[model samples]
Target: MLKIGIIGYGTIGEDVVQAIGKDREGGIQVTSILVRDRSKYVVPSSLADLMTEQEAVFFANDFDIVVESAGHGAVKLYGEKVLAHGADLIVVSVGAFADEALQKRLMQKATERCRKIIIPSAAIGGLDRIAAGSLGPMEEVTLITRKPPKAWYGTLIEQQVSLTELTEPYCAFDGVARDSARLFPESVNVSAALSLAGIGFDRTKVKVFVDPHITSNTHEIEARGKFGQIMLQIQNTPSARNPKTGYIVAMSVMKTLRDRASHFVIGV
Candidate 1:
């Protein structure tokens, strides 16, 4: 079994735990969960036995992988440590890579420790095709994301426009993927993933919009290169626990874990 530790018990973390519970034979197991404050954490009945608050608990176990579903701060705190401890790191908070220094450091740690840094397609799809096209001479790669008004709550976009009173689609941000992660960390994991896969952060273009009429989180990717032109779009229902993230995000994480132990695999 692939023993794993998960950081945080937020929406994505809870969903991932429940997913692993549902598939007991998938060859993945949750060894421990690290939370900020165990006292305040109300563990779900099913996962009560796996909760832990100490950092030492992670190092004690023979964890094959550690999943980071917490915010970027958690990634900054535990990313290198996890790699150094001999477990592959699955980073759900790809936005943390916005800090070039931190990204390089974690990558160096992974390289030195001989552990992999996995980035799942949590928010969007078509990354495999984009990464493949990147081998050729790629000219331009762009990502456009649109989400309902509620999804923009607590984000920096509120200062730009009134999300609640918006009548039409409002463009919240337009810039390179690096700035996208800085400005809207919670909302633009797709941009960060795209930038890393297709091109460097400085070269990848990103646009974010708040659409009151739309009920789902929408993402579109367009790339033109010597390999060819690729255009893809997906509409995902927002997670009920958190409007900022799509429900499929957690499912993608589960897929990544399951793929590791599956005899038959698909996709890149």
Candidate 2:
């Protein structure tokens, strides 16, 4: 069985573990989970014996892979240590890669240990073509994300734009992928993933909108290059616990974990 260590037992991490538990015979199990405050959460029976402090994950030899479903802070804190210790790191918080130095350090550590820092397609698609286009000449790659105004309540958008007064959709941000990912870490994981696969962060365009007309989180990706134009739109349900994260994001993590244990892989 594949032993998995998870960083942060937040909404995404808990969902990932619950999905794993549903299929106990999938050959992957959560061996250890690290959270900011363990006392606040009631972990499932499966992880009751394996829960530990965030630092403990670095020293433990029990897990083969570490899934980072934590936020950017957690990734910065434990990412390099986890990879340096010889465990493959599955990064769900791809937005954290916006820190160029941190990204380089984690890549260096993984390379040194012969481990991998895996980035999964969380809530968007067409990355295979985009990644291939990177080898050729790519002209443009734009990611436009839309969510309900309520989702922007506590974010920067709220301070700049009045979500309550807006009756229609309004574009809240327009910038490069790096800034978008850093500014909206919780909601824009797909931006970083798309940027990493298709182009560098600086070149990737990003637009974020708060829509009173829409309820679910929507992502529209447009890429034009030597590989021709590829456009993908995915309307994902908002995660019950986290409005910033779409429901499909957690499922994507589960799919990535499944692919790790499966003998026959489907997509790239």
Tell me, by TM-score, which candidate is best.
Answer: 1
Across 196-259, the per-residue lDDT of candidate 2 in tens digits comes to 9988899999999999999899999999988788988989988878888876777888888888
Model 2 misplacement above 4 A: none
Model 2 scores a TM of: 0.96
Error of 1 at 114 (Å): 0.5
State the lDDT at 89 in candidate 1.
Answer: 95
Clashing pairs in 1: none
Q: Write the per-residue lDDT of candidate 1 for residues 1-268, one digit (tens) a residue.
A: 9898999889999899889989967689898999988787676765776787888875788899999999999999999999999999999999999999999999999999999999999999999999999999999999999999999889898888888789999988889999998888889989999999998899999999999999999999999999899999999999987999988999999999988878878997
Where is the poorest 10-residue window by lDDT in model 1?
A: 40-49
Q: Each model's C-alpha lDDT?
A: 0.91, 0.86
lDDT: which candidate is best? 1
